[model samples]
Every structure is written in C-alpha cells, then in structure tokens.
Target: MRLAAALISCVLCVTGTVGGAWLSRPASVDYGSLLSKASDIYAVTDERGDATRLYVVNNASNAAISRIPGAAAELPWKVNVTYSLDGPNVEANEISGASGLVGIYIDVKPQSSAANHTIPVVTFTVPTQVTGDISADNTASVATQGSDIVVAAAGNVSSGLKFSCYMDAKK
Candidate 1:
C-alpha cells in the first residue's frame, strides 16, 4: 500500500509540471498593439503619392482594411504575402524596379476570447516606377487560400493600370 501511494504522487507531480510548462509558453502576437482587435480586411497605400491602390480581403468575413488611391503621388510595384504554421505576415514593396524597396507590416486583431494577442499573417513589397509619372493608373489585389499568398497588378499608359494576385494552398 505504501509503495503504490508513493508512485501515484510521483506521477501526479510530473503531469502537473508538464501541463504548467505548456500553458506558460509565450504568445505569437503583441497584445498591446493595434492588431489586438479583430480585422476582417486590410489595404496598403503609398504615403508619398496616390498612384497605386492595393486591396486585401479576409474572404471568411469579407472585410476591407487597407487602400491606396491612385498613381499621382503613389507608385506601388510588388506585394508579397506569406502564411506559415507559426502565423501570417504581409510585406509590401513600395518601391519599383531597381530603385529600392520599402516594406509595410500588417497585424490582425485577435478574437475576443483568444488567449494571446493578434497575429501577423502577411508580408510583401510594393513596386516603384522610374519616371515617376503620375499619368498612369494602377490597381492591385491580394488573396490567400491556405498557406500561399497571391498578388496581381496591371497598368497601362494609355487607359490605366490594373493588377491582381491569388495564392492557393499546397497539396
């Protein structure tokens, strides 16, 4: 009887220690940031100019969070998005061609009952132009299916510009 009681107590101690360690792990998101609230959609724009507009959609809820007006002052080039097992992060390339690249970071707000803060699920860069011409118009779109991120943008000197991208999950 005495041996059995001692073994039981030892097992309980080990189980409690393991459970506490798992619960004490750090969260992936920063609770104090703007992304602490829920966000259904988002957009990206250039603060310098209004030349390009990048639109993002959270298809599950169908919300739009970010936007860029036109090609007058803003010129967006490339937008890259990545979603991993850890979380999601979006990067916007604000510069075009060989000039350089500017990165924009996005954070999603957490759910009301979530244990941690909001997480970042996308990352990309915006494209830039060489001539800095404000005459052309451009539009871009981004979407995610599972772990992949897609972006598409199109533009024309005569009519205008339009681009769209969509990424599907891997098998």
Candidate 2:
C-alpha cells in the first residue's frame, strides 16, 4: 500500500509539472516574414494625402486608379504592414463598446536595387466592425490571404468579427 501511494504521488507531480509548463508557455508571432512576399505595394491616400487604403499592383493599371496614391509604386517598392490591437502601436481609446477601429502603419521601402532612397512609413485607421460571422476567441489575429490583409479580433464582441480589408491586390 505504501509503495503504491508513493508511486501515484510521483506520477501526479510529474504530470502536473509538465502540464503547467505547457500551459504557461508564451506565444510569439513573426511579423517581419508575414508580408515578405508583397511587392509594388502602395498606400492609397485621400485628397488630403492621408493614407486610407493599401493597393498592391497585380495586372491592373495602378497609375490610372489615382495619381494621389503614395509613391510606393512610383518608387517600385515593397511594403511591410505593422499592425496592433491595443497598446502603444494601437489606438486603444478608439476600440470602445461597438467602435471597432484599428490603427495600421505601413512601411514602404525601395527595392534592394534602390537601397539609397529613404524609407517611407504611412499610418492609417481602418474600421473593423464586429459581426456575428466571427468566432469569439478573445484574441486578435492577422494574416494575408492572397491580396487581402485579413484582421480578425474576436475578443471585443460576443460573436466576434473580422476585417477582411486592405490591399486590393487585384489580379
């Protein structure tokens, strides 16, 4: 009886330790590699020159869309989108109640051949209203599916929602 009890306790201790370690592990994301394949990415700006959208050159005529867009295409550059939910990089106050506003910043750099030019960073705000179609996971996630930069934040609402917006990489 004594030997059995000691063995059970030892097993329980090992199992608990392993479970705790696995549960407490911190998660990480590789932002740099996310948009590494994106090229000829442009920042769409309003009449005032404020970035309102992102456009990736595909087979369409980017120049005919509007000359007001950022110089990413003119400079023939690639872009990196740095995104956030609620922190220094995000506009935390704008995400109150039903307001689903997210702050997005894009870094535009010249191609490797034009390395001498300066890097341009454009900032903008996008509305990601919550909807029933989304699942409530209480966490934020982002990814580039084809030409779209999909941002889903399920923590804000009960049913959760997603913002399948940005980068009209029309083929």
Candidate 3:
C-alpha cells in the first residue's frame, strides 16, 4: 500500500511538471513571411484621412484577417467583415446590462511601404452591433493639406466609420 501510494504521487508530480511547461508555451509570429506571399495586402484609411482600419492580426497564428465582400472587385482595397453571433471564435466577452459610450484608438498607415503614421480615435455607443475585429464601411480622406498629403483626418464622422487609404499590389 505504501509503495502504491508513493508511485501514484511520483506519477502525478511528473505529469504536472511536463503539463505546465506545455501549457505555457508561447510562439512568435512571422509577419514578414506573410507579407511576402505575393498577395494584394493593404492598409485602408477613412475619409477626412483617419486610419480607422488599423491592422488586426489573428491571435491564433499572427495571421492577418480580412473579410472580402462579394463585390470586392468593384472596390478591391476596401475591407468588409461579416459579424457572427455563431461564428468561430477563440473566445467571447459577456456583457451584464452595460450601457455607455466607448472608444478605440487605431494606429494605421497610408501604404504598406509607408510606416505606421497616424492615430485615429473611434468612439461609439455601447451595446451596438459592432463586432468582428475592427472598423467597417465609411468614407475617409487621403487628400492633401497644403502641399503635403494630409494623412490624419480628425473629427470626420464618415472617416470614423470607414477606411479610405489602401495598398494595391495587383499591378
């Protein structure tokens, strides 16, 4: 009985130690490799020129997530997403009768070759049907200020909802 009890304890100890290490394993994302895949990757902006559509990498494998609508050919650079109530999710957040306004700050750029340049703040009412990673359809500005291009479009409501600036490698 003593030997059996000791054996069980030893087995449990070994199992837990190995299991803990396995559970805590972390991995690195190689964004460079994904970017080099010869696909048309773009970072879109909103009207007035705010970068509402900041990049949202998949937490699963650091993969870039994009939802192309059926009419994507008409506007290839646009980002469209489908909200899922029963969609595949790694997890979900629960709300307990919460009511208030909220805001999100997104850091984005005009072109993929361009570095991250602007910060756009998006605020919306709570309990709204906004979901699926990032901002959606609206208008933005990638125009000019005086001579130089005006990259930051602040206080633009349409710009607050959609992305205008984009990258097109389809040439």
Candidate 4:
C-alpha cells in the first residue's frame, strides 16, 4: 500500500513541476511572434558614441526545435540591421570607408544571461566597418554550463550619418 502511495505522489509531483514552469512564462509567448527572450536587451555604441540595441530577435522555444544547435548553451538571437551614409558635401571615399557605422554582435551564452547578469561574459569594441584589413568577420564564443558547447557570432551592420544609432526590437 505504501509503495503505491509513493508512486502516485511522484507522478503528481512531476506533473505539477512541469505545469508550473509552463504557467510562469509570459502569456504573449504563447501566440506572439517572439519565440523567446534569452536575456535582457543591451545597448552597444561606437567610438563616436552612437548607440544601437542588442537582443535575441528569434529564439527556440525548446532545445529539440532550435535553429541554432550550436547555440544550445543559451537561446540564439539575430542581430540584423543596415546602416548607410551619402551626402553631397561628404567625400565618397569617407562614406565608403565608414559605411558599416554601427555594429551589433553577440554569442548567446548562459552566463551572459540571468546567472551572472551583473557582468558581461565577454566585451570588446565593435568593428567600425567591413573591410579587408579590419576583418569584420571576427568572432567570439562562451562555454555552456552543462555541456562542452560554445556559442559564436560575427558583427552585423546598421546605418548612419554623422553617427546616429537606433534599434528596432519591438517585433
């Protein structure tokens, strides 16, 4: 009789725990386009002090369905943007050289999220432009807490003129 009672208790405990987790998530997450929010949004600026925001634009709701299997350590997000500058007064060479005025880059890892929210797991200057010499394709990564996995990414661009920055994460 005691064995049966304990088995029943274990099943109920598991069900309750799973149910509670499902309920804790924001309701909008159920029907909205946002798949998930791995960490709070962050703002990154350039040498000229123009600021652009960063966040995971799209994330997997579950590990089995993740588009970024390599980023399994933390939810993966897309940093998509385009920046441009053209003016009659400005020199063509100057515009072409500094075309990618704003950069947004991130390697979604667990530590960069809720666990060590006080500090950035990694930090470095944003690449000023996409040039053969500068190598805007530079990358970085962080280790996952539970696995041997690492998350990595290269810089992404956003437009500018005299260095202005903006982010569109409402979607």
Candidate 5:
C-alpha cells in the first residue's frame, strides 16, 4: 500500500512540474525600427485642385527635412526616382575628368490647373524651359560639379523618356 501511494505521489509531482514548465515558455518578440538609413529619403505631392505643397522626409531620422511650396504641382499617380554613379572618369573637351551624376524621373497624371495644361519635364540644367510633355514615365539625368549641374530631359510619348547630363570635377 505504501509503495502504491508513493508511486501515485511521484506521478502527480512529475505531471505538475511538466505542466508548469510548458505553460511558462517565453513569448515571441519583434523589436526593430522600419526605416534606418539616409538614402531612404523620399517625397510625395498633395492632391490636385488644392494647394501645391510638397512633403519630404527622411526615413532614418523619421523627420520632415523641408516642406517647400511649388516643389510639386499636382499629385502623381505614381512617382519613381533613382540615382546612380555613372562614371568614375569622363572625357571633357578631350581632357580626362571625373564627376558624379544624379538622375531624376517623374510621372505626373494629367490635370487642368495651369494655363499650358501640359505636363512639364524639368531638368536641373535648364530650369526655364518646359522641356516637353512626357508620358507615364519621364526620366531626367543630371551631372553635378560642386554646386553647378547640367541636366537633360528626354520626352517619352510612345515609350519612355531617356536623358543624360555632364559635369566637371573640381581641380
């Protein structure tokens, strides 16, 4: 009788201990910030028929760098911009030179607010000219030397726009 009682007690103790351990396991956790980089900056314009305001922010800092007026005219259905290092060295007037190139592409939905009623593809080089109207995909390339920059905008009516620019490196 004593052995059977002891056996029952042992089983109960083991079951209780196992149950307690199983119930006390740690829960899963997710700990990390979504944005964490300087190159992660992006901007988007507000809706049309309203104020022409631009919203710019950096993901790393999660802060608004600037909110300038006239930055963008209308809300683009879709906007995509990319930059790349074109060449380590370039030829300038038969002379070897080095410069950095930055490209910007914008696609704006057709809207009626301004007089021209034409979507303008502006470049850093000739900020004055309208360049021309672009299709859904507009690409503009610019090369920078110090503060000066030269830009080219290619109009894409049937297809897409393709442009290029040149810059001179500081001596």
Candidate 6:
C-alpha cells in the first residue's frame, strides 16, 4: 500500500510541475525578423554623446532585405553578430585585439514606461546618416529567449578598423 501511494504521489508531482512550466513559458518570438531588423537599425560606433534614437523601420524594402538569402550590412569594426538560444539579454563576448584596442558594445531592448506601465513603440523617425568604413560577416542569427528575442555577437579587432564595436535590437 505504501509503495503504491509513493508512486501515485510522484506521478502527480511530475504532472503538476510539467503543467506549470508549460503555462508559465512565454510565447515564441520570430527571431529571424528581429535579427534582420536589428541589423538594419544602425548607430554610430560611439554615439553615446549624441541622443540617437534607435528604432526599426517597417517597410517593403526592409522586409525584402530580411528575406534575401545572403544579405548583411557591413559594420565598421571587425565584430560579428550572431543569434543564440541562451541569453537573457543582448551582449557581446570574446572581445580581443592583437594591435592594441579600444572596444565598445551597445545593446537595446524594450523598455516600459514606469509611470504609464506601457511599452514605447519604436519606429523609424528621423533619417540620420554618418559615413565610415562599414563591414560585417554578411551573417546573422535568429535566436530567442522565450518570447523575447536575444542575440549573441562576439568579435575581435583583428583587422580593418582598429576600434571594435557592436549593437543589437529587437522588434
């Protein structure tokens, strides 16, 4: 009788745990689109001084760019951005340089208004343009964390621009 009771208890515990986890899990995010949007939204390597507004544009051309088989925007620094399944936040890792270094990384995510308890809609507004040597791996990844999209980009200033920097965004 005790053995049967123990087995029943274990089964019930397992079932409840699984059910709870499933209910708590967030909806899946379309990481591919988010990654593409993130890449499309660009900021200066060191635009901390300027109050640059970062937002994603929803247009035919931008969507078409995302669908392109082999299309990627080149970044100035020798940094590589990739998608990953494991990351609570967008970040850069494995930063190194052989010929001296001054590296920087920028990550952007949804921020809710504290007073209003509402998320601000990020849309492309002003057209800001600056010129520099742009280069990238012509590659990206569609990684996610539950319903939130996350990216993992890591690189070193091995060649090209001496200073390395990277940026990320989500839609």
Candidate 1 root-mean-square deviation in Å = 25.0
Best by TM-score: 5
Candidate 4 per-residue lDDT over residues 105-150, each given as its tens digit:
3232222223222212222222312321222222332222222222
lDDT of 2: 0.34
Best by lDDT: 2
Worst 10 residues of 3 by lDDT: 1-10
Off by more than 4 A, model 3: 1-28, 54-171
Q: Estimate candidate 4's RMSD in Å.
A: 23.2
The TM-score measured for candidate 5 stands at 0.24
lDDT of 5 by residue, 46-83 (tens): 56645464333344455545656675644322234433
Q: Considering summed lDDT, which 10 consecutive residues are worst modelled in model 1?
A: 1-10
Q: For each candidate, what TM-score against the reference? A: 0.15, 0.19, 0.16, 0.16, 0.24, 0.15
Error of 1 at 164 (Å): 12
Better by TM-score, candidate 5 or 4: 5
What digit string (tens of lDDT, one per residue) describes model 3 on residues 32-69? 86655534544566657766654533343445557676
lDDT of prediction 5: 0.32
Q: Whole-model Cα lDDT per candidate?
A: 0.27, 0.34, 0.28, 0.28, 0.32, 0.26
Q: Write the per-residue lDDT of candidate 1 for residues 1-171, one digit (tens) a residue.
A: 111111100121111221121114446965444434434324443577654743333253655344354454322222233322213333333222323222222222222322122212222322222222111112333433234333323222222222222222121
**In model 4, which regions exceed 4 Å deviation?**
1-68, 75-80, 87-171
Question: TM-score of the candidate numbered 4?
Answer: 0.16
Go through the candidates in order and give the clash count of each: 58, 0, 9, 4, 0, 3
Worst 10 residues of 2 by lDDT: 1-10
Candidate 2 collision pairs = none
Write down the lDDT that model 3 would get.
0.28
